[model samples]
Target: MLRASLLASVAATPFFITAATAQDYFDIGEIIVSGGLSPIEANAFGRASNVITAQEIERRGLTTVQDALRALPGVSVNGSSNSFTQVRIRGGESGHTLILIDGVEAAGGDGEYVLSGLQTANIERIEVLRGPQSVYYGSNASTGVINIITRKGAIGDTYTATLEVGAATTATAFVSRRTERGGVALSFSHLDDRGYDQSGDGGEKDGLERTTINLSGDYLLTDDWKVGFTLRGSDEEADTDPSPFGATDADSYVVDDPDEFSTRDERTASIYTEYEMMGGRLTHRLSFNKTKYKSTYSSGLPVTRESEAVKYRLSYGLDGRTVADTDHLLSLLVENKKDSSDDNPLYAREATSVALEYRGSFANGLDVQAGARFDDNTVFEDATTWNVGLSYQIPDTGVRLHASAGVGVVNPSYFELYADAYGYSGNPNLTPERNESFDIGAEFAILDGRGSFDVTYFNETLIDEITDVATGPGAFSFVNQAGKSDRQGVEVSGNIQATDALNLRLAYTYLDAKNPDGSVEIRRPRHELALGATLDTFGGRGSVSGDIRHVSGNYDSQFWQWPAPTVELPSYTTVNVAAQYELSDTITLNGRITNLFDDDAVDAWGFASRGRAAYVGISAKF
Candidate 1:
């Protein structure tokens, strides 16, 4: 394993970037919104999580949401180098990581979900909760959850616009206005990239284009009543690539076929109301959410696939802190959701769930939390899940210890249950995959809150996994496998402020993911490392930052092709750097370079990675 030496080398480089100058840190606060039913201080939570703010995005010159996610703990991405793709947490499949836009689930029925199209134009912050969250998020949260919160209009009028040109061209604009009783914000962004070639031999560049728009508004109807709505939509189109079958009839990817292309349209809408009752000790929230998605892929030949899904969700939640004074909290949630699609019976499914949670803090610096949920699915039997956690802080010191455990379940997808293609048939009796996960960790900070460290050990076992099995001669169908997979690992992360204006950060993951047959899971790096640094430079008027990532090779197999067998997927490393300069009171200049080493490594054993590239942009506001 090329893990130890390589990882150590990368981890040690950040220290050298420490600046000699001392500066002040941007104070945000030690708070996390997704770790609990409500907002909680980071030091009081007995779980592990990472937060990325919009200011950090701008400082780092992160162009896409995917780029930002790759830096987080336990995130892995595939595809999107040329076309749409999937991203998973830890060693789980893409479907195991539940994605939310403003607390509303966005995954749809067997098509390109909006995961690839989100433009980060209106995002205020992103919260990543690692480990099983099915008790709170319900379906498809067996591994982790990514909650994206967008900006509500500020208390005053604001407007900003930016335009960039490079290997990819981008445009972004935002406007907002607010009064004492109400506020509204609107954002629009477009990206067009003449991306790298996708063919094995490299012939034509697979271009991609996307446009996204977001609108959000909130109104305070009365002293203790408020209502809000969030709306988002995007359009995307991409050029071609081929399959691994090399010009054979079995090759569905149509290799190097520039004539092959795909198009997608997606929309998400949600509205919510909040009311305070019982002398301000109790509060209730009700929300309605819906997502509409459609996608089509066509090749030069007479082959094309079109799919669509519309999902609707309704939820009501209650929260109170009067159970045992302000030290105790209680939460209740009820949700109903449905997915519908024409020409696909399995896509027509419904689910309902109820969840309850309680948290309390003791005078001795001890915190306890527990939650339970019951879910009923139209296509599967009812299931119950629960989670518990504990946190303790050593008095007067910046040391804290924590532990958490949870159960998770994921219902079968529409394509897995009903798609009939390539000599395979869907199985109506398929059941959901169940998981039990456990995690323990400790966090400590020294040097007057300038340095911090965290170490966590996590393990998960999956049961009743749905897989294809031979049903008859020359035919295969979906069935439940008793034991599917296991994932266990250690995560280490830290940050140190070497100087007042310079900070160094590092994160590493050691993963041991195995299939039921004792083989390693595909596309999961056994060892992953990330290193970063931010420094005040150019006379304090400009700042510069850079990050490095290293991945150890894993295993993969090309299904639906001849000689399908697990093969080694090579590992690689890439670096990114960015610089910003304030040109004036209302204008700023920014520049960035991606893949600094020009690795051009094959990404996830499919497409070629972008080589060394640079871009410069300017932003203006009045």
Candidate 2:
């Protein structure tokens, strides 16, 4: 019923009476840290999660980070080449989604992550935790978890800069400070794109380049103690178009060369410390992290290949409280990783993890969550994950109900357990790739603070799953897949503040991914939609926004489609618009238009998507 005609068109609008402020952010301070046994409220998280603040990415003029996650709700993103952007959750596998920046372990090159060079300078919000987070993020996260939070300062000193131009060219700078105790932030971003000829029969013009830097700092020794630091870096390049340009057969998608390219040289760093004495409700945190990924490939002949990966992490967290409503959290982790090529070190792995969480909060409001994890991998066996969640609260009818059950894990990378490539012989008894999931939801609240609506249903099961078995005259190995694989979905979202100056949002998803004999899952999509609105215009000094998207069309066949063919890929829609204006008190001006109606897309079945573009910018505050 298309979710009852989109909640009956948001209950037929008309709630415009203005004049009321303070009590939104979805009523009661949004907070979600993987949403389970600790930081709650993001509408009391018990399962589904999606939050993109920073004022909705500056009122939706969003620049990257996959276009602010394409308006949330079970996110799906195909390609636009930030070196091959691909992220899909709920329909899974874009390296099985798991990326965290502020919490370390920035998933990159090795696992899966390439969201269009991710440049959202000094970000300050983006938390989307949709499902089976391996009992709170442990091991490739099995389809969900993207927590990035930057910009740790705001209030006192500030500086900002921005520049934008035509078919992609952007520059940004930011500086920050906050006093009361501590804060610091710095950011830089640059992106260039000439993009848009990704084959489809055109020639050349498949460009992209990026540069980014971000940092955060903090210190506050007393008042319960604290210390922190974070750093991020990036350099990217992309230009690989050959999709159907020179393809004859061999299943229809090609890119052998034409000045091919690929590059990434990333870096991440972290340090942390936090403490609070029992009198302050016992809490602690300790951390250290490092990540470096490098990759390069060329297409000028003579084969140029380079690879590198380095990761190290150490973490600790504790939060305790045992009385009146209960609480508990304890997490410890350690990981050391490596993958290298030109200087040797082709293998190395070390791991240790532990988690235990419990949270109860009752007095009839009912809420309970449980968690467990124990992973100790050095290549295989010794894994255990768990999760359980429930949230009630229907008593007075504001309505809320939630449910969850989880288990997730993935471990087997480095070309999926070592690839020999020349002779194709590498399979170290492959393991880890387990997933089991569940979800249930409901939530509604309308017309008081304005509006809200929610829904969710999910199911998953995957086991072993490694895939690539065949050994004979043409060798092949790396096996595991021997059964179970499925995914189920339903998601609907809503929001309406409809008048204190207009705001609206919508989301939808209906998916069913498979492989237990019901194959068909390449590029995922099985219906998805997103709509948006925001307006404050003129009298409030100016603001306007727009968004629209629709997707449904997927299939590319996972290899060997020799005589099978039938790569159905045909649905698409896109529109975007944005605005901002202030021009005084420190000045501000912004603009955006992306694919405003250039519609004629393809997000993988042969790339090519991106048309009608425009952008303008100005911002200053110093």
How many clashes in each structure?
Answer: 3, 0
Give per-residue CA lDDT, model 1, range 195-302, as digits (tens). 877654567888889998888777778866777787888788888675644533322333566777877777778777766566445666677777776666644322
For residues 428-533, write the lDDT of model 2, one tens digit per residue.
7788888898989898888875888889899888888888767887788788878888989899899999889999999988888888677777778888899999
Per-prediction CA RMSD (Å): 8.2, 23.0
* Model 1 error, position 198 (Å): 1.5
Question: Whole-model lDDT, candidate 1?
Answer: 0.72
Q: List the residue pairs that clash in candidate 2.
A: none
- Give each model a TM-score: 0.89, 0.31
Best by lDDT: 1
Stretches of candidate 2 exceeding 4 Å from the true structure? 1-44, 52-58, 63-65, 69-113, 117-127, 130-143, 146-165, 168-258, 261-363, 369-384, 390-407, 422-427, 433-535, 539-590, 593-622
Candidate that scores best on TM-score: 1
Clash pairs for candidate 1: 23-500, 23-501, 242-255
The CA lDDT of each predicted structure is 0.72, 0.68
